[model samples]
Target chain A: MNNQLLPERTVYLVSDGTGITVETFSNAVLSQFDQVRFKEIHLPFICSIEKAKEAVIKINNTANETGYPPIIFSTLVNIDIMNLLKTANCIFIDLFGTFINHIEQAIGHKSNNSIGRSHMVSDSEKYRNRIDAINFSLSHDDGQFVNQLNKADVILIGVSRCGKTPTSLYLAMQYAIKAANFPLTPDDFERNTLPATIVPFKSKLFGLSILPERLSEVRNERRPNSKYATLEQCRYEVSESEKMMRREGISWLSTTTKSIEEISTTVLQEIGLSRTLA
Target chain B: MNNQLLPERTVYLVSDGTGITVETFSNAVLSQFDQVRFKEIHLPFICSIEKAKEAVIKINNTANETGYPPIIFSTLVNIDIMNLLKTANCIFIDLFGTFINHIEQAIGHKSNNSIGRSHMVSDSEKYRNRIDAINFSLSHDDGQFVNQLNKADVILIGVSRCGKTPTSLYLAMQYAIKAANFPLTPDDFERNTLPATIVPFKSKLFGLSILPERLSEVRNERRPNSKYATLEQCRYEVSESEKMMRREGISWLSTTTKSIEEISTTVLQEIGLSRTLA
Candidate 1:
């Protein structure tokens, strides 16, 4: 076993574009070494040498403060900026360099190596699709545009504060899916059926339920001391909504403990929508 | 050099929750090796041994069909299920096991190893914060809720279809940032200043502009041949909006060629908002 387990260390996520790719990558690798705590600093849009030098200074300062060499995870495409960053007092992990070289060797051609190419809106068709999805999601939110229900790829239904909107937006932004979400209010629970507007789209409906106490807590934060925020009302609503889902043969999952990402993924999986990179 | 370059490979992303962490991690790693094409399959909520067996069968069949060991990137926390998956004929990359062990040792306690813990909305404070951010973004979208402009952590200004909505949603969903976006219409450009409602919050404003031709192309797809979709109108809007931003001393960026992630990162950086993982 490696004996280099430190109590804490500084980590820098450097990127020419969003720094999201490097951040995600570093988190994954660092998650494996749980012995060390990381104080992460994100440096995005380091496309110029001046910015790169500034990043080096920041990284070195972090190293000096921490009394240990920082770990710098970078996805820089520009050779000059990459070289400048290399002069920092840290262990540099080049996320793109080796892979680009390998790709060049295998394809027998040079890469564009343009800064910020990975996250560019270079493909017009994909960009249009994403924008269309976003527009559709926004218009269809909270059952606002019921007439356009037919255009939806997935319709998420649940009681208020059950995490419908964020999940819908995530589905739209991440996968370009036209996800519409509707709230299952007390009126729907009293009727004991899905909303009339979404009835025609039962095949596309997915449900999200939450623990009654948790639901009450979430609702209370929004509207305290109201019938809508009462634990009894929350329990009744959750049970009735879930029952309605079962009777309608719509699949449902609990949002009591799941993140928006998890809820969105389950919704997509239930709707049989394949994840696509846009 | 080893002669193991394949034209295509099957990549399975297996997880106990959303599979998002594994998917993001795998994509970042695979982006390095750009030569090989990946046919990615996402298998989420694999929490049971039965599901693990099913995943193994699917993985083995993929391997047999491809005549190469399929690469399976998993974030399963269940030891028994992990062992079961190991029976499959594929290259398994364990994302959690080693880290959990190291963390357990360093912390001097055993990890709960509960499935889907990373993305769970278990903490009420954080969950409320995220929901609040999402609500703020949605309510303030397209300059609708300008009266509440002061509540925004960042206010993004751009012409229509300049990728503000998606970026705002991303920032809210990912980092719990209360981002509001206002569209820079021809009216705002005509005045040659920031909107009156947002003038007091000038420090929170950022701008997004796009190439006029690209803006025209994007708009034409929505409302073809109309004044709003005409190339001349788009050019005028783009140029005027940029000039207004510059004259007001608001930092502006071109969204014509940038992705939402890139745009959001730049916005956050310019506003000095530290990226916080929720």
Candidate 2:
């Protein structure tokens, strides 16, 4: 480590609101650059061009004051504000600009105007189904009293008692995702496929399949003497439902053993979506 | 792109809760297994020896039913679960066992019998600091609502108008985190340092800086003619606040140019903590 003699290099994640994703992706990436002096800052609500210019100027001045030519990682809405910072002697990474370029490249078409990250995964078909399944699940199941999950920003699907409710509430509370979940039931096994209503929006469909034994154990906690808690029932329903999934060729992932951090990230990555940071 | 008949593969991610991380990690490691029928299930709450035994039986049955021995990727809580599953005809990838082994072998001393991925990270000092920073940020400067933050499971930090209140309310209503927020005041800038009380818990510190113009624009919508809404003031405040963060050695992030999903993910990652997914 060159800690004794090298000057610290810093990178700033200047943003508009919670500075959640930019900071996250940047931190994760920066973690890979452990040797560098990378720093981040959150500048929320930079909606206007003038404010962007001033932030740019401030960054420039701060760079000199700190004796470090800090790199500016900006995620601003105003394009012109980026321009005003042209003379700032630091790397200006405009996430929006990068996204626009990526969109233009990914689609093999360059538009007259810029694009955004939503365009990054506009091609996801499974995400569409998950959303549709969620809406249908919400409508049919009452979403555990969550009211209309049609507006859900996120959804959870897993075997019975696989921590869907708590996870949903966690996302809703921690990230503001209108989260919802639906258990894979014997009914789903009898049908051997996702609900018919889910067919139209297969792209959004995300799956959460946990171990049958675990499902049995959890259900046992709630209804110990009933068939729901029986390993046989758990086995039958899980197998049949999975068989049906294969028959229909629907792709899904298991949640039989993972942490909440991993599960949340899986959901985000699956949908090409991000969650709000604190 | 050689489709190659979509290689038959079975992926597994066993963990204590939601199982999202294993799914992502498995997918990232997919290239190593090009030939196999993929089947994975997440196992929840493997805190007991009896439950772990039941899980093993289920896995054996799954392998038999699928007509192929499974390749199991798991994160179990109890070492006994691994021992129980050892006899099963499967290729097992156990995260906790592997990591524990590494830690044990590296220090020439066995670990403190800590199990689970969440506990795995908790064993590290750096992760703890980052997590502490996020948690602290979530509870800091709650304004006149003193002591209200004591009940907070998460907090939102950002400029004047970065959707903190909405995000806070969403979390409170949906997940039950007593979320609270405070606007970064001029006094904080004058001090150019975090509140003294924050020092003990810098590990939970999280900063949400937004784009200045966006802050001004949002303020403008509410007050219309106040100095807080002025573009110049927005620029000055953002600049000064950023400067103060640097002077005080506070690492912050920006909230601009990101969707709510991204923001949420960043915060969760920073805190290095997750509410019970179940």
Candidate 3:
């Protein structure tokens, strides 16, 4: 009841681009503070002085209402707009402003100081590569297009609902890595060998396993009351898949409590593939 | 040739967890220096003193070989390990070390001082929500599942290869929004109306568009020499789709030169949906 009486503090994510970078960075930092009940307000594309002034008004209003100043994490590139935002009644943490001049001194050059440089289509080749990677992951999802397995940077093998698809797509979308995923069905377990097509790319194979209880829960969402969703069946598949992975000497991780980002990072590290943003 | 002769400068992304946030922050900051060509090296999972020592060796080696110090962007939470890293022979930019103190002061409390708190599965409910959103987006891609359009936060409609699939997936993956995408076909263009299944949820509709020349180029990569990949057909489909979207009073944007982040941001802003991280 006392917690409920506390007013929610405001945290503004201000950026001249999509605010994606600032949001990610802020989440990483703010997640460490568990006591503050933060209400995030995104002020994206604040490219002009007018927009900055408007954001200032919003920030000041929130501070007035909450009786506590808002915390603003801004990544503005324009000097004039940033100066305007700095005047707002808040704890202004300028992300770019804090680091840009230091980087300039170290690199011995001036920054481009352009708006939307981080998440824009400045390099057409890299943009096309990312699109192609996404298309590849889509077609190759769930062993759909096994014919192009040779082009994949990593082949993820796992039982159904073990988080193969999301991990593959994340690797492709964020890192521009062509990741193909294949499910280990009952037949593969019976045969007691890796999938024939994926055997050729053994060096790039990564396996995902999950806790049987959790796997059954995830499967029940797709097909309730079916044998596939039974706890016994999930246990069987997970054990067999682990055995197969061990026999094939493929690096594997349990995805029972891991996020997609964690799984993708582990997969890239195990496969010795350094992440390259598209 | 002179540009090629310049030695590739190293930029180390050091973090205690998956390093996703640090990589993103580094990219956003380093992208401003268009003149410096950086070679990124990931030193993820650096939670131990041993790992931090190894990173110092690598940074020093790189500095010795290149005759210039590398730029190290780190987000380590361990004060002891971070202090050790500060002794390395490089331009150290401590991401967390720089701002965590200020945030602690402003919030009037001590941080939890935990490792891997951001990208880890710390919140099980939010993690499940993200996984569920990904599954929903995958099932609804290219108009596969229309029965649950009412449950979606946003529905993206556009001509084939006009950047609907990637945009939809990015929204789900990054923002944990239930985003469904439907491809506008020639038949829809001939009929001159939105799809019947999507008409009921007109308020949730958002559209994406692309240049005909770019659309043709993207399509040709998939199905070469087909009528669908021709410039004329792409132009017809794009123009008709735009007209239909305008007539139906749906907000839309051109994705021809936009990144997935940019397109997703615009869609969320236009749909009046505040991005909620699951």
Give TM-scores for every candidate, taking all chains together and pairing residue i with residue i: 0.87, 0.37, 0.97
Task: Order the numbered candidates by lDDT, best leading.
Answer: 3, 1, 2
Residues A52-155 of candidate 3 have per-residue lDDT tens digits of 99999999998898888999999898989999998989999989879989988988888898877889998898888898889899999999898899999999
Write one digit per residue (lDDT tens) for candidate 3, span B85-181.
8888999999876998998898887788888789999878888888888889999999998889999999999998888898888988998899999
Ranking by DockQ: 3, 1, 2
What TM-score between 0 and 1 does chain B of candidate 3 receive?
A: 0.95
Docking class of 1: acceptable
DockQ-superior candidate, 1 or 3: 3
Residue B191 local lDDT, model 3: 82
| Model 3 steric clash pairs | none
TM-score of chain A of each: 0.89, 0.46, 0.96
Regions more than 4 Å wrong, model 2: A1-9, A15-21, A77-79, A98-162, A169-261, A264-278, B1-149, B153-166, B169-278
Interface RMSD of each: 4.8, 12.5, 1.0
lDDT of each: 0.81, 0.53, 0.90
Best by lDDT: 3
